[model samples]
Target: MAKAKWRSVDGIVLLNKPIGLSSNQALQRVRRLFQAAKAGHTGALDPLATGMLPLCLGEATKFSQYLLDADKRYLTCIQLGKRTTTGDREGDILTEESVPSLSDESLESILDGFRGEIEQIPPMYSALKHEGKPLYEYARQGIVIERKRRRVTISNLTLVSRTADTLTLDIQCSKGTYIRTIGEDIGEALGCGAHLHSLHRISTAGYSPENMMTMEEFEAISEQGYEALDAHLLPMDTAVEYFTKVDLPETDTMNMMFGRTIPSPVSLDNGTVVRMFDQGTQRFLGLGQIKGTMLRPFRLVNTSEFSL
Candidate 1:
């Protein structure tokens, strides 16, 4: 029998993506740096935006779905008196309006209108799928389609600063919320149209930008004879840290590795997500769903250790 190729350690990388590069481009660079067989990012950020981008490698990719639903936070600057085709500075200026002079009190009042739940129509220049194709495809052909409004919650919206033509804001919003649209809406409320000039994602879920690393820094260290960068990599179970923990005995662990459900030692009446660990060795088995006394297999991690 031939031996399988051994890959490096598996985990997640919190990349502080630089501006002017797409998310996929950044992912490819990191993948090549690590010589990893598989890698995936939790979400996508636009080329013009920079911030905390979580890149999942190896088994960590299995948990990317959980991070996608997590909340995000951003700081953006919107230029009033101008509207762009792409709702951002990268697009051509389509229309221009006179800047309305307003006091800080007036601006704060307008921001208060967007503090709660609201519906927003996604911009045409997004990666949203329509009829099995991306919306950006239609946009490149100068075609615009009517987008439906999606309900999103804005947990926090504050005017950090304001100038004569640009308004800077700090916002914490739910998943799928668009800061570009919020900039446009704020302009409309203030009687002047606006467009996003700059955006920086400060955090995702609970992961902050302060913990991210730049591509340049990562590349520099790799070139200096560093073999393993796994120290900075977060464990796959880090995403599901909010879930409950369950330890299984040898028999139960063996049954689970064979794709069998077994009784759990802990009694969780309410359905809950749990991280399973081996009782003797304390090794991560995978994630499971607990209901009453039964633990059903959700995602098995030690599949390689067992044969069907």
Candidate 2:
């Protein structure tokens, strides 16, 4: 059997992650299809969740943190009257109760309490670490660790739909906001008890959910040719689109390539992050920060990596 050829690839692919696969599982599948030498996911979705899982390839990996730290939106279905150990469908049913009458006004009132900023204790079955091991590892061993409350902002949270046993919600919140915890907390507030019935990330980091392609779609594209696959990949600059952009002259860009801080062409506030491009060719040169009225290279792209 011949070995598959994997080369450097630089771009972002918006993957509509399917259920039954962990975030890493989905990333690996996409990476293999691209024959990418390096890749990473912006954020991890639970095996039971399905949603936008952005895959960063090669040079794009350097900017993945911006996506991770960016705000996210999700559509979640919360099942009332039952609570699970893992807070989602994957866990054992821990408690059950009769669901209360869910009227629009009452539900809105309950949800209003969760809007804006609120404190939440991270779930036991989470990837967060304690002493260098994932919290889920200890959770699997039936060890309960006291977790500190984290403050998260829910910019938008509205009831999308509701049934006798379930409530659907559209939520836009800051990064690190756990949808499962929201469902469980809402259920608790209603005296019905609750667990996450389903979750789908609608968007993240200003990337359109409409651009997300499913695994099946990716497989079909792979059959067409590398060109077809490359067409779907967004440029690495899109990863840091939130940052201000500045173009440096050829000589200054050359200095930047060597990690030198060049004078900002225009005055910029200290700590302002900017994406740099070559003034003449306009090719992306990576990112920089304005510190002490100078543009200091934060992360520079190595265009030579793709020469192979």
Candidate 3:
């Protein structure tokens, strides 16, 4: 059969990623479904994780960096009393200990220490590069490579509930945090080793899973054609909606799009980034940042193609 022709569709889709597919694998599936000429994902979730995977198609891909840098939240279950090679249920068990019966106050105190800023040693089973090779490759070869401890902030960490051998947590953290590492550290503090039993991203980039389109749902709507699928996508500007919005006159909009810096209509702190838009129509132009007193375009959309 002949391959379908790809089209230039633009927008964001909030997908409730099912467990077992890597982020890139999930992205490819969505891209083919939309038949978009270009597509990207904000960040990768472990194959074991499920939920809130944001897929950006066409011009929406341009704003994915903001989503990548945005704070994220997850609901996870940390299995106590076991240390695994990969730090999750996927890897082989290296050690096991009897989980201690503890009071809520004691468990809460141990979790508190993990809150705020903490340092973590990236796992060998991760995609982090070591001498241009992914760490996981070395892990597969049984070669223990020296790793460095990197700093990350845990904005919020709440103990949701606990089972006989599992502790469930609701974690909101900054970019670059590895929940697997957090699980190990928390276990060590509690005098029992631990590994992540399950992970689920609850939200990121100010978006939640409540509006997500699941794969099961998409399969049901698949044969209805692309226009039906398009109805589910969010406008490209929604990715950068957290930034301040600045409406510009037509002349200013043209100048900004053409890579010219224009005088600011309203004063904002130097280096403050804003979303640019056409004044009268409120059409999104792109993104601009304040330099000294001028608004310099940083990332401008192709107004000729989509935005007027």
Number of the top lDDT candidate: 2
Runs in model 3 deviating more than 4 A are 1-4, 306-308
lDDT of 2 at 109: 95
Which candidate's TM-score is highest?
A: 2
Candidate 1 lDDT over 96-149, as tens digits, reads: 889888888878888998988999999898989899888889999999889999
* lDDT score for candidate 1 against the true structure: 0.85
TM-score for each candidate, following the candidate numbering: 0.93, 0.96, 0.95
1 or 2: which has the higher TM-score?
Answer: 2
lDDT of 1 at 152: 95
> lDDT of all predictions, in order shown?
0.85, 0.91, 0.90
Clash list (residue pairs), candidate 1: none
Candidates ranked, most accurate by TM-score first = 2, 3, 1
lDDT, residue 260, candidate 2: 94
lDDT: which is higher, 2 or 3? 2
Where is the poorest 10-residue window by lDDT in model 1? 1-10
| CA lDDT for candidate 2 | 0.91
